[model samples]
Target: MTNLLSTSNQEEFGLNVLIIDDNEQITKMISSFLDMSNYECTVVNDGKEGLDLIKTNQYDSIILDLAMPEFDGYEILDALQRENPSYLSKIIVLTASNVPIENIQKFKELGISSCLQKPVDIDQLLSKIIDSSV
Candidate 1:
């Protein structure tokens, strides 16, 4: 893990974040913003690829989208829950779907740090990443 010191003497650190979204444009946009913020961002366009990366690597934070053709976000979450429950705390769900409140609550119960509906405010995502990394 890389340690990126904050601008202040308090010494906050930036994290390595993984972004799993099928939308290439969205991934590119988020990756650009995160790169500017000093967080190491790795993006994948397929859910299966994202899950494979998660299994093989360690990430301080994850920005996940709920919808995908194969191996959707839910599957990724389930795998993480079964294999690495602790990692769930680092997740930030970013979905464009109009999911029910109950499902949102379910995700929260599974230990996701936050669930954001797209088009997510980049500033808010940055803030959440900073907070979670600490």
Candidate 2:
């Protein structure tokens, strides 16, 4: 079967992606890789900023980290889902936390599109984005 997650099809797609992560290196890396694609990326180092950005803009996807000060990814997700369910479908959690089965269930309940564990696998991240767009 053909792998539908290939980036070859992404040329026709134009997306605005928000990446929320506390790790500077990871954020830069993810943004760099994503920028090389057809997507526009805006990265924030904390949940509060991420939340604020989400409030002000419409993003095709959100790559959120589970751990952060003040507000966590879950909190942001909850707030976004409460305020706008349409955006909820675009969220993808990028976390290093050992997300439990129950938590995963909760993520699903909150309408998270996908959850990626860190240290981020670039190929997997790209694949997820491609799959999501498709």
Writing each residue's lDDT as its tens digit, candidate 1 over 12-125 gives 345799999999999998888667656688999899899889888989889899889888998999988999888888889899998789988888888789888887766687
Q: Which portions of model 1 miss their true places by more than 4 Å?
A: 1-12
Each model's TM-score, in the order given?
A: 0.87, 0.85
Q: How does candidate 1 fare on TM-score? A: 0.87
The C-alpha RMSD in Å for every predicted model, in order, reads 4.2, 3.1
Compute the lDDT of residue 12 as modeled in candidate 1.
38
Deviation from native of the Cα of residue 128 in model 2, angstroms: 1.6
List the pairs of residues colliding in candidate 1: none
Global lDDT for candidate 1?
0.82
Roughly what TM-score does model 2 have, to 2 decimal places? 0.85
Highest TM-score: which candidate?
Answer: 1
